[model samples]
Target: MSAPLRVLIVDDERLARERLKDLLAEAGDMQLVGECRNGNEAIAAIDAERPDLVLLDVQMPGPDGFGVLRALPPESPPAVIFVTAHRDFAVQAFEANALDYLLKPFDRERFRQSLARARDRRKALASPLDTELLARLEALTRRPPHEPERYVTRLVARVGWRMRFLQVEDIDYLTAEGNYVSVQVGKQSHLTRETLSALEAKLDPKQFLRAHRSFIVRLDRIEEVEPLPPGEYVFVLRDGTRLTSGRSYRAQVQRALELPT
Candidate 1:
């Protein structure tokens, strides 16, 4: 008697998406509106499709599930079921006011329960952007407070449906491209749907320096720092990639490279 709930599935893993698709099909009361492999696509789908519910994956390259939720400006985003492979994110997922958090490899019964909960909560108009939930999510994504001061060791990036895990040491530099950040590693570069400011917060300041508004360079990778005329400077990476430092960031750049100002 009730109208079928429109649903969207967002996950980087093909098998995970396929499994959710099959399960949703088996659930008689829901209709699949669209499928997105990454957070960017998911955000676009949410804007375009405006589905009644979103099955969001907790971890992915770029925006991830939490980032997607934070991006939505509405007080009440469509119902969401946080699907993730990591059990450690459960508390934070709920704290972010999710409809439910579905752990990876969930059985049909568990999946159905999650779906049912979402269905029941569909009418709630409260926004998922609660301050408490957001704070928890921010903490969850960073290194634990108790651990010794450390920087992120790995970066996850998604291209189409493929996910790439880049080691921090392998990264040559980072450049801002509009709303995305280009993660350059060796000859390969992956565009991630994340703001430079947000990504900078996660990086270790000791190893990476924001040489310019649009650029973040790895300290040990600098092969040379050429002092250009007119008080400008250019950082040459070990691979010969040249990144110009911004005029306003000159002092920080000098200090970072230990160049006498």
Candidate 2:
């Protein structure tokens, strides 16, 4: 018979650690080697225990999950299944790289699925931290926790004969114009050859809001909001530009405005 997989659970919350311990106990083929409450402890535990798999939380004091991975030796890093509450771009990056990630509040079935995938990879002797994954972890670790994840502070726009750099804070709103996006600043509009959705991904969600399929307005620039029927609304900007919210973005708009849903 194959040996049981040794597992380490690393999370700041005691309840989260306990929950993982309970689940690990239910898996007969898995053995709980240790539990860590923070990133520093996790890093030390990883070195001391040398577990086969780590169920890691992203955010914690000192070094984060990314940091713990970063501290590991490049060769033969343990298999990882990130378990965190963050639903940020990093999660998407992890998915794109074909890494296992279990979002917080995951069900027992979901946990089983993630663990099974990890076991399969281990059996196959696949290297968990590849060049690309290491590069992504390096980038994520460099970002300041207070600032939004790699959000743009400025954007390049073409102005006839010259290239202009526009501060994101100065822009009032953005609207899609066919294959291009129009950056509206007061009365002047600068056209940039980029899709609205693509541009929106780089902007901070706290500062910019997608009001419709064709429009993205600065949250602070919104002077007033007029409610419309069927969970829709008309947002009046500081420059007197009125943009209607899309039906599909109702829940997001409500959350941004702190309105009763």
User: What overall lDDT goes with each candidate model?
Assistant: 0.76, 0.77
The positional error of residue 237 in candidate 2, measured at the CA in angstroms, is 37
**What lDDT score is found at residue 63 in candidate 2?**
98
- Identify the leading candidate in terms of TM-score: 1
- Runs of candidate 2 with Cα error greater than 4 angstroms are 92-98, 126-261
The TM-score measured for candidate 1 stands at 0.48
Error of 2 at 248 (Å): 51
TM-score for candidate 2: 0.47
TM-score of every candidate relative to the true structure: 0.48, 0.47
Per-residue lDDT tens digits of candidate 1, residues 34-139? 9998889999999999888999998887798888976774333577799888888775565345668888888999999998776655422222334575455444
Q: What is the number of residue pairs that collide in model 2?
A: 0
Candidate 1 C-alpha error for residue 21, in Å? 0.6
* Candidate 1 Cα errors over 4 Å, as ranges: 123-261
